[model samples]
Target: MAPERYEADSDPTDLSLKILVAGGFGVGKTTLVGSVSEIRPLRTEEQLSELGESVDDTGGVDRKTTTTVAMDFGRITIRSGLSLYLFGTPGQDRFWFLWDELSQGALGAVVLADTRRLEDSFPAVDFFEHRRIPFVVAVNCFPGARGYGAGDVSRALDLDQGTPVVLCDARDRDSGKEVLIRLVEYAGRMHTARLLDTVGRP
Candidate 1:
């Protein structure tokens, strides 16, 4: 399917779609939102000092100082008429309660994974699964992160056969937009399937 393209002057109300970007700390969810957001992305960052050493995991992301304390909000126009609202979830384990409210009306999600700590994404993956929310897994390509194919990540996540897994550079606008398109397409397919099931069609 051709990707949707959005131009300026589109009505936000007419094409608003909410999608969640979720992952563990330092996994690039905020970067992905900023890369494609047409509006000034809203971020709530709190400095992580050595005092946080008691609670923060400074294993691979030792240099990181700030963490997303709340959700990151951004907007993207993908087609001449379509627009998407990107809601990046707080990655810290303590703020997971916010996800339940965020997921309420969301169409779908993109779970970002850093190969350096692929296991860190398990909670985000499990959150969507537990809620039966449709989502795509985007393995964010990092400079020193381990190299893994999409198929390998899919296997590691044990996702359904129909789930979409794509590689992305969250810092690149085109790459971030492509990941959003994948989530849109995945959610569209699931919506169609649900409608068919409701109509008693295979």
Candidate 2:
């Protein structure tokens, strides 16, 4: 299916969007949302327990104690009358059912990647790709994590040629904001192209 189009004459205020922050377990989805949001982020994180430990893999992120069980909600104003409502998805497999609900009316998505566990983010990339949703991969640079160039990470992920792969520090507001900006710009371009195609149709 073709990607969704944004009306060329739509109001800027009406352009407020729902953007998903999807990634694998301990990939910093929650951190990214909270870092860049202008409003206080709402999180549904719960302390990990023995029951969860049995199913949740904390191999690289063993330092992490909490998990987002449902989702993280936040808001950011990109510019005058243009805003984004971010919905950071729960990374564990059990909470994946919530993704269907969170993704409704979404404009685009950002799939965060952790180099320490590169394979963990594959599900997010695949989901957006299959859905034809505009998305960008933001590699969250953690301390002591192996360094990978954007091209190397892109190749490792088997990403489509045009997909944007950028480095980010999810814990930093500026870094996280840049990731969103990149995604918004990419999605905006795709939307504009779709609208143009529609206009040019005979």
Q: Of the candidates shown, which would achieve the greatest lDDT relative to the real structure? A: 2
Q: Compared with the true structure, what per-residue lDDT tens digits does model 1 show for residues 48-67?
A: 88888788886887468788
Residue 164 in candidate 1, Cα distance off native in Å: 1.1
Q: After superposition on all CA atoms, what RMSD does each candidate show versus the true structure?
A: 4.0, 3.3
lDDT of each: 0.86, 0.87
Task: Estimate, for each residue in 1-202, the C-alpha lDDT of model 2 and write its tens digit.
Answer: 3323333245633557779999999999999999999989999999998887789898889589999999999988787667788999999998889988888777789999999999998988999888778899999999889999999999999999889998999999989888888999998887777778988955
lDDT (C-alpha) at residue 107 in model 2: 78
| TM-scores vs. true structure, each candidate | 0.91, 0.91
lDDT score of residue 147 within candidate 2: 93
**How many pairs of residues in model 1 come into backbone collision?**
8
